[model samples]
Target: MIANKSLSRLMAHVTPGRLLSLGFVLVALTGAQAQETAAPPPLAGGSQDEIKQFCTNIADAARDQRYLLQKQDLDKLQTEVNDRITVLEKRKTEYEDWLKKRNDFMKQAEAGLVDIYKTMKADSAAPQLQETNPILAAAIIMKLPAKQSGLIMAEMDPKKAGVIAAIMASAADPLTSKDPS
Candidate 1:
């Protein structure tokens, strides 16, 4: 009963302003303590300088590992490029072989055509040559014996024969032929 009376007397003496001030003080102390605990603890054994030295020691090793990985990537890219080049070379060789075969076939066909024209009479050959491409007609005439070519030209229309002759003359000596602009 005496303790209760003393607590009541103490409460009666404390004003609202004093109680508010006490509450603010308690809050401030609690905040300060929380801030102190929030900070990270220092390393258990190593000093700051030792930790820095350890990081420095590993720097070169880390850089070398990174370089090795980059080199591996470059090597893989180079291998791919080489493989593509090899494939392209193979394709080029195949194309060259096909071109050669085609050229050989064309030459044989031209030769056979010349032979057929050689056996034909000028009257029969002239009309056919006139109907043919001028370049091809000129080529055929150039390949024939001079006597047969003359006979064929004599039998052809004058305009057609002149054009064929001009083509033959230019083909025979391209350097000397004047461009008929």
Candidate 2:
């Protein structure tokens, strides 16, 4: 056949070195083509589709677990807030009790102070009361009999007596007189 004759002619002209080089070139080309056409190895987990399906299956459960964790954190925060509120309430109760006891003691001390002032001479009591807190002096004077209060006021410095009188007036009518200052 004409093709066989041409192949024979081509083989006859090709040298041994040329044939060896041609074989190498062919092998190189074939290896490159094979590499291009071959599929990459599958991942350790599985094929892409299987991995995608696995992730899809776990998505809802993962989301639920995340939400549960968030809820637990919120619950813990709420409990801490509640505990702080309870402690605040306890402190408030203690403060109120302490204030009430302090007020009761002040009232008893004020009564004893008034009794001492009542027995003293007006001149002696006036100087002592003036040296005391003006508010305390005023309270003592108010508790004294009207005649004794007048005697004490008559003996006090006019400016101090006037300040005490204003305090007494304000105390008497708290709604109308808010502050002596």
Candidate 3:
């Protein structure tokens, strides 16, 4: 049989305010229990292994993309370097060809000058010498025979002859010069 005294004591403590608070506590505990027993909807990504594999694939793809970009940059740089080298090589070849042509032209001009002067009359040579610069006239006169050079100089104006003579003297071999040293 129930103890009426203990039951009466318990009933006395269950006031309206205490009853509402007890109801709230019971509701909170049941709500937690319900949530614990329930299953959440499955994710669209499927199993944990699949999601892990997908993440691994994404990481691998990013790494491969970076590598490919670096490779492309290197290839572009290499192409630029190769193009520059080709241009420089072409320029070097052109310069060598130009130098060779210049040397050939100089030889031809020297030969032509010698042939013309050798065939030219002293009178004709004199007028040409007077028209040319003193330095060039001196060089041409120096290449002629002593008799021919004298005839050419005699035909030149006295002032022009003096200038040409001075240029020739200055260009003479040091050992053969009028200078004592």
**Model 3 residue 120 distance off true place after TM-score fit, in angstroms:** 1.7
Provide the overall lDDT of each model, using Cα atoms, as 2-decimal numbers: 0.93, 0.92, 0.85
For all predicted structures, in order, the TM-scores are 0.59, 0.59, 0.39
Error of 1 at 91 (Å): 2.1
Tell me, by TM-score, which candidate is best: 2
Over 82-128, each residue of candidate 1 has an lDDT whose tens digit, in order, gives 99999999999999899889879978988999999999999999999
Residue 55 error, candidate 2, Å: 9.3
lDDT sort, best first: 1, 2, 3
Determine the C-alpha RMSD for candidate 2 after optimal superposition of all C-alphas: 7.0
Off by over 4 Å in 3: 1-104, 175-181
Clashes of each: 0, 0, 0
Q: What's model 3's lDDT at 67?
A: 100
lDDT of 1: 0.93
User: How do all the candidates rank in terms of TM-score, highest first?
Assistant: 2, 1, 3
Off-target runs (Cα >4 Å) in candidate 1 are 1-17, 36-62, 122-127, 130-138, 150-181
